[model samples]
Target: MKALILKRYGSLQNVMFEDISKPVIAPDEILVEIHAAGLNPIDYMIPKGIFKPILKFNMPATLGSDLAGVVVEVGSKVTRFKAGDKVFASIFDLGKGSLAEYAAVPEFAAALKPDNLSFAEAASVPMVGLTSWQALVVRAQTRAGHKVFIPAGSGGIGTFAIQLAQRLGATVGTTTSTSNMEWVRTLGADEVVDYKKQNFEDVMQGYDTVLGTVRGDALEKALRILKPKSKIVSLIGPPDGAFASRRGMNLLMRIVFSLLSRRIIRLAKQQDTHYSFLFVQPNGEHLAIIGSMLESGQIRPVIDRIFSFENAKLGLEYLETGRAKGKVVIELKDTTI
Candidate 1:
């Protein structure tokens, strides 16, 4: 099997397209002939050793997090699905190996693909869908009539968040460039802030929750945009109380971050608001529910582009631009069932 393997942790140049042994299914797993795979920021970050401390990436890694495909063989314990069953899932929890012709995924982390979607569409659902679902529904307890603000509304998670938040009856507001303003409104955002032309913090106020996918000062600005006692969920790093001590960091830098985070933590306590730094978790059950919602027309997959398997590098480059309106996928050409 040919896979995009990372023999060393460095830049994207370290990634090599080479033949590797196909994965054998575990007793509780299923072998999937991957039809498409979705790219996420973590896919690139993990291989570059940037998340080395927290994510614990092993050398010679294969980098992909979400996939949609058909089950070629199911283990004896896999009663929910069998050969020829179509499925889609976040393979992030199973380890990063979805950037290949096949992957052996644990049965519980995979779900039946929605009947209404193509493989590319289904592949777009797993990681960002899980992120949107967890942040809006689980963590923030978004309910009907609630007001929510999601940043980067036309991007992968924002696209899903806008739809899911609206489905739960929350009046959603999102920030995007002028080019994507109408796009997000179609996704159900009640109001769209043109970030390039207007500052969202200046115009938008009083939100039950805010999902921030931005970094630097923009991330700090998101905290100010929320109402008192309201929640803010950050997908980027450096939020209050998110302490992950790295090994053998210079004492000076450690002390500086500790004091800075402590001050932010204190501020969060004073406002009576909660803060959470989110990394999505895997759940086949959640994907099944999302799939049902997709089939019902309550949600839709937002795909930016689909590249042929040989052009997977171009997919990664496009995602790196931070301007994709939605998920980008790499499509494979194996048609056998």
Candidate 2:
């Protein structure tokens, strides 16, 4: 099987194709024949060694996290799925990747693909869906009458977050280019900020929650938009101490993260707002619920482009450009190496 694998960290140029043996599953895993994969910002970051300290990988690691595939074999401990089941999963932080012809999926991370979606669409849901579900529903506790600000409203996380917030009855506010203002509004954003013409902090106020999708000063600026006792869930982060403690990092690393996030922490504290960083975790049950939402048309996959598996490098290149309006997918089954 040909797979795009990292030859070394520190550069995307190190990622290349190689024919390797198919993965052998453990008793608690399923062997999936991948048909499609979704590319995220993290996919490119991995090869750049951004997550090296925490997400350690063996040499030549496969380079993707999200995938939709058919199960060729199931583990003895897996009861929810059988051979030939169509499944989608985010195998992130799992020490393996999905950008290969085959992957070994743990039972806990595998969910049946929604009947209403194509393989590429199903592949696009897991990471973004999980991130939004955790940020808005689990962490922020967004509810009816609450106003939630989600930046990058037309991006992968933004598109899903807006719809999910609306489903939870929260009024949504988001930032997008002028062209995508109406696009995000249709995704359920009640307030749209044109980041070009106006700074959101200047115009949007009294929000109950802010899903911090953009990096740098955006999270701190978000503090201005929220009311006292509100929450900001940062997806892009100089990760906070809470995240460090949850991941069980060493004291040295925990201190490093603390120092990294101290300014935002103090700024959030000064405003009486709660700020915490989020790392999306994979859960099949959560994906199942999101899959149901996709099937019901409560939310839809926003795909910007689909590249043949042979052109996956181009897919990653395109994603790295940060110009895509939504998720970018790479199809595999009918594509050549």
**Which consecutive 10 residues in model 2 have the weakest lDDT in total?**
328-337
Q: Would you give me the overall lDDT of model 1?
A: 0.82
Please report the TM-score between candidate 2 and the true structure. 0.98
Question: What residue pairs are clashing in model 1?
Answer: none
Best model per TM-score: 2
Instruction: Give TM per candidate.
Output: 0.92, 0.98
User: What lDDT score is found at residue 85 in candidate 1?
Assistant: 93
Whole-model lDDT per candidate: 0.82, 0.91
Q: Kindly report which residue stretches of model 1 are placed more than 4 angstroms away from their true locations once superposed.
A: 239-263, 334-337
Q: Count the backbone clashes (under 3 Å) in each candidate.
A: 0, 0
lDDT of 1 by residue, 1-337 (tens): 9898888888888887988898988888999999999888777777678767456557778889899999999998888999999999897846658889999999888999988888989998899999888888888999987889888898888898899999999999888998888878999999789988999888887788878687667656666667787887777755233333433455565665456467545566576677666768888988898989999999999999988889888888889888788999889864222
